[model samples]
Target: MEPSSSPPAITEPAAAGSGEPLAHRRLVFGIVAIALLMASIDQTIVATALNAIRGDLKAELTWSGWTITVYALGQIIVMPLAGRLGDQFGRKKIFLGAAALFTVASLCCSLADNIYLLVVFRAFQAIGGGAFMPTATGIVAEQFGRDRDRAIGMFTSIFPIGGIIGPIIGGIIVTYWSWREIFVVNIPIGLLLIVLGLRFIPSSVPKATSRIDGTGAFLLAVTMLFGMYGISSLGSAGAEPTDPLFIVAMLIALVLGFLFVRHANRYATPFIPISLLRGRGFGAMNTINFLFGAAMLGFGALVPLYAESRYGIPPLQAGTLLTARAVGMICVAGLAVFALRRTGYRAPMIGGFVLVAGGMTLMSLAPHGLTPYAWLAMAAGITGIGMGLSIPASNNASLQLAPDQISAIAGLRGMFRQSGGIVAVSVTTAILNHATDAGTTQAHSFVVFAAILLLMIPITFLVPDHRGTW
Candidate 1:
């Protein structure tokens, strides 16, 4: 690491008249928020239509699950590379490129006639979508010269906004129109982001010496692919963890994963710096973000399907189950923005985890005498509140420690979170594919995962938790 004597990347607050106009800064946040919204919406919007998509495209349940998994898979694979590229080529360049790719790919997704084509398009869409967080965050870090904490804390609220809109819009489209409409929805939003981004997003200095680590990236990708295959095997009829395919795939992934880490440790310029993986608070933060992903991306996507299978809820209402969660998040997210400094990171995060666990446990019990929809919605909302309480704290906690490498830190956080989502979706599908009663099995899975989430609480102590900047 650079010696403490080195000048910091960002110095003291800008003078009253030194920075860009306040309105322009607001416009910039608006642009990045909208970009994030479009991508976040895509994440939840498709969940409501999983069954519909499967039926329309004539895909097997296992294959249909790929619609979600592949997107996350694409994201995890591209994120580290995206971070480096942003550093080397300027954040605005990468941001605009990502927005354009996401827009074009969404159009392709809407036009796909087969499941294979749709999945391919979704993966391509993810290539762009995956870059959004790292690049937008770098842009935000530069623009928010002062009150950085408040600005970033507020940024956490944007996802819940997308979370709220995605499922509701998804429900409506899946209920009355074709599922294809979901992807079509992104076209205009993406275009607007691109146009505004081109005109308004300020450019950051590129690091001429930044280098990409192709070897490490390939190993990581291969490892995940093998691991995904192993997980998918468990969903097969009469399959077990010890099945030859599962064992072989997972063992290979394990070996490769080890190698990837070893490579990162030794390489002069690694794909993701080893310190980010194992450095002080960084390692713990990555772990927390990974688990958080299961709560945010995994839980939201599966609820609609769970509600449908378990209670025979219509697509419209089932989709709102996610909305309920987002609503609860909205309730707490605003508070987090203003109150984060007072509560610090650890308290809110641990509390959030407990709430998430409690909410999941609540969802599992549709008691003998209650309305399932109300009960589940309440449960989801509780989970949302838990997430809202923690998100800003977690988002800012890691960045504060490494302000200069904003994009890299943000990308690493995103990679772990998406990795968690991938694992969650994979496990859920694997179980559903083999289960006799999918709904019952899935509900029980929620309780089991909730228990695991609760078990993860002690690890939060390892995370950084100061009231102000690190």
Candidate 2:
């Protein structure tokens, strides 16, 4: 196929409100919100409990790390597909299916006898989890027509709540009960969402019918696999960057990545739209978001482990470290979300990154005069404030450039950050496997991450600088 000047049109259903009452629409929104919160919590909840899982399963650092890696991998891959599937089929059917799938997968996860089993089950859980957003977004978009932006914003805000509460809840479960209790807790909640959804979710007709780009999906998958494996191998103690195996793995990833890009640019309906990647203003936002994902979401995943490993803090306490960050994030993110239309994208984002970088630098340092817990909490809070300030703008920056393709833009933006996260955690775990002092190594890694965040500041100038109050 020849390359096109623009991406294939995203299949946007008519923006019709089906005469649903405002109270009714909110009920539907709440049902989906519960599932979203469940999925969101699952993302970070495991971080606090991971060490316990590893010790119980007797898994290696790199292998156990795949626990986080696999979930992200599944989500990035499934998101675009889910969006199209929801539009092709009915959103109601897709929403209920995803919820049921997540519930069943949670049960399977709770029963896993080993880390390998858990990873496999976790991938299925991720597929269900990944489907929730696009399908739910479709449901909400139809529910509130002119007010969709506000509804969506309100919906999106639920994510940080999950981030804030996930670790603390996980910490509590693991502290009071077995780590399996984390999964056990989901079973009841998931069931409730499914029943509530069936009773309340409006039935929307399939808006479009189309096929997914199998070739593009395949190439993207293999490319990430090769890159992840190469990094994992090279991070070993005796393995040099020049190692033949590492070089081969990376080369394969590069070649495959090139093919994936070509397919994306040229295909009629590529798995990932080329326009989203190369569109004006898109390049800057995607790049900065990738770095943001690596610095905040990716490194943030390891904070509990870092606390437990470096400071010899207990699981319950280490878990609170993330809570501290979330506390800061919630405090600022709510304000930033409301402020974005007034301040423009640049202010909150630049300020957020500065706080993030400074906070991370503080975390890397010793307690100095304060207790390790107090010192780390203060640093984490500082970092959280940075995240809170920036995240809302980071989310909205590119969307303004191409509002029609909201689903595609949102999926791709998430994919970049998640892709960055997969690589970061993969490499970090690989290095930790060989480190003589895991804590010191992890601390030093944060410093390096902070330095990298500093370099990202100048690029924000390229990001969309206008306020959205227009």
Candidate 3:
């Protein structure tokens, strides 16, 4: 195929008053980072708190799993919509509104008396948090137009940093206070972001005139929600994969999913542009991202439960143990950037998946017999390193392949990764529910995760070994 023409240069929103002073740019970057950090940390903070929530709410394990599933679903649903909304409205308007919504939702979560209420509120919180991410990315890209590469580097680092610290913070809070504090803590931060954002964040004019693809969005949301619900139901006690309801939901999801693809292809402005997916390297990178997200976040979600169940570790200790993975990710992320510079994208991409697969294999062995805590932590760390290595490389590769559609590509990447998270949490929970033995069930689940990661390794080879810098 002939090389596609370079996309027209992205112009900054005229209303935002580009070419701001250096100090002003730094202030905006800080605001964006703060917003991004809060959203990122929220993703993992609840992983360690699931047990506490279940006990407090008198909820079944399967239902409690919805707390994570619903939040991710909300994110997956809102990411693309949020980007388009931001483009249609204004970044500052959407960011502040989302921040405010998040603050209110956090308060509601803290006050929720039942698991059902908590899940509903958590979804709202996710809407706000999810919308903040892409909009913040846009803000940074616009504010630091020429120097966006450096700005983006700083912006992206917040995710790993937030992930690294989230469990520790959640543990300390849950230990001293209650899990409610986890949501409560966001209130103050969210409010501060709103206040700061109002003062520092510039408003951008609508850059695009495309209509929101409401039908496509609704169809896609139904597809994911039903698909996940069906998968999770398979693991419920007394439930069988062949159950009529489960089969029906899956069928519905499949049908809607097919319709969504057809709709996207025909729509003038799709939530996920079909052309981007058709690009040479873009689809492969996203596939790797999807699998990587499933393995990485799925394992992270289950580890605390594994530790608590096997070792009778307290929530605080379990949370601390979870940090080993983050340590690996944070430590390796910088090194991965350098490694990418030396070996190009292919080595890091393939090597990262290999490490993750290896780590999952080690983790799967834990259920059969006694394994040292240090050994488990080492495995977690290795998985984290793999995540640190591969994620950036894949992201860089996607940009290299579709630099013209960077915004759309980034949105799709987030959507696919969160979609993986939804599947991982649901499937792992289902496996645990159906198994008679916790150890064996978890072991089996890790093995499945390992297999998924292993499959991603070869797919990474399909990505062009692009040596160019972003």
Residue 421, model 2: lDDT of 71
In lDDT terms, how accurate is model 3?
A: 0.75
Q: Per-residue lDDT tens digits of candidate 3, residues 119-143?
A: 9999999999888777876777666
Q: Per-residue lDDT for 1-470 in model 1, tens only?
A: 22233222332123112443333566678899888888888876887789999999899986787887788778787776787778767888999999999999999999999999999999999989989988888777667655566777787777778777876788799899989999998899898888888777766677546567889878977887788667756656677777889989999999999999999989998877788887558978888788877655677668888999989999778877877888888889889878877888888888888898899988988655668998988899899899888788888888877776778888888888877876776678777877799899989988877876786688778876778533
Off by over 4 Å in 1: 1-23, 48-62, 171-181, 236-239, 309-312, 366-369, 432-443
Which regions of candidate 3 are displaced past 4 Å? Answer: 1-25, 47-64, 146-150, 153-156, 175-179, 308-315, 338-343, 366-371
TM-score of each: 0.87, 0.83, 0.85
Residue 244 lDDT in candidate 1: 88
In model 3, pairs of residues that clash are 235-430
* Candidate 2 worst ten-residue window by lDDT: 1-10
CA deviation > 4 Å runs, candidate 2 = 1-23, 47-65, 87-90, 113-115, 144-147, 154-157, 171-181, 203-208, 232-248, 308-312, 366-369, 428-443
Q: Give the best candidate by lDDT.
A: 1
lDDT: worst 10-residue window of model 3: 1-10
The candidate that achieves the highest TM-score relative to the unseen native structure: 1
